[model samples]
Target: AGWQGTAAQVVTHTLNRMQDEFATNPADCLAYIGTCITQPHYEVDERVASRLPETHLKPGGKPGKWMADLKGANLAQLLSAGIPEAHIEVSPYCTWADNDHYFSHRRNEGTTGRMLAVIGIQNKPS
Candidate 1:
């Protein structure tokens, strides 16, 4: 699938699952995703920053793309879903727009060479 289609599908599926989980246990239905940095002309609203403790706003690096808080956007989503302000956690590092450690879609000028890291835990019988 194309990027937009894939993203839409993932979001739709996640929302459906969240609704189901919330019906049973509301507290268990938390969603977290990394958001792309937007232009500074767009405001990073206070409802987001209040929850995330480690949001950074880097200045004057790129022309159109300003350093934004991905975790802040996620925290804002959680807060909008009625989750407590203290429950969310934000990373200290700026993902793409700031450091070279992470690949940026914006910086690459629409290149398809992005890398991602995912972690999970497996259950073991004791």
Candidate 2:
């Protein structure tokens, strides 16, 4: 399903909820991949659009439609929640725009898709 609220709201709520149960902070570092700010994927209510950051919203091609910057919104929320700017890295790629490199359910009309995520810790030099 699509985002229930602005990306900022969704990200903030999720981080807060995770913090409640996790022993460590979730805002230490963030790496965003796919679905970049370049894609105008949201058509939201004006009230919700008003809450989004300036860089995170733009006029959609059609009236009453607004393109939202998903990654920008999440980055804003993470920074507002005390995460350092240096610790956050946002990818320049957009899954919706790059069909050959990424899978997008919306672009494919729910026919098929795949998810990939990777995380690792580097070993300290002796």
Candidate 3:
């Protein structure tokens, strides 16, 4: 399958799994971290666009690869799962593709290292 189709399947499956998992193991809050490449829509190929469910072909940035609001998409998913907007947090960093701090598949052409971000609440002291 192409990247576009793979992305769509992953997002849909992940969201569905999250909904099921949260029902049995609910968290007080959720955090989403990653870089959403900010660019013009023209930069993204039709196949890429078709895979993304939250892409808006809006203008107002670089000439290509219109900004993809991953955070917004995640928020929407969370909201649909009954998670309030206020309970979710999004990071501002753009990851490796947009920044040197992280590894980007686009920048390195699938030869980049992986960056992981983990989240969990610590037990409170009585």
TM-scores, each model vs. reference: 0.44, 0.65, 0.58
> Better model by TM-score, 1 or 3?
3
Q: For each candidate in the order shown, give its overall lDDT on alpha carbons.
A: 0.43, 0.62, 0.51
lDDT of 1 at 106: 55
Highest TM-score model number: 2
> Which 10 consecutive positions of candidate 3 have the poorest summed lDDT?
33-42
Question: Stretches of candidate 3 above 4 Å error?
Answer: 1-27, 39-42, 59-67, 96-98, 119-126
Compared with the true structure, what per-residue lDDT tens digits does model 3 show for residues 14-100?
A: 556755766422345454534544433124544455555545444334454444454555555556555556766666655444557
Q: Number of the top candidate by lDDT?
A: 2
3: Cα error in model 2, Å: 2.8
Number of clashing pairs per prediction, in order:
0, 0, 9
- Runs in model 1 deviating more than 4 A are 1-16, 21-24, 29-35, 38-71, 117-126
Supply the TM-score for candidate 1. Answer: 0.44
Q: How close is candidate 2 to the true structure, as a TM-score?
A: 0.65
Which residue pairs collide, candidate 2? none
Model 2 CA lDDT for position 86: 82
lDDT of 1: 0.43
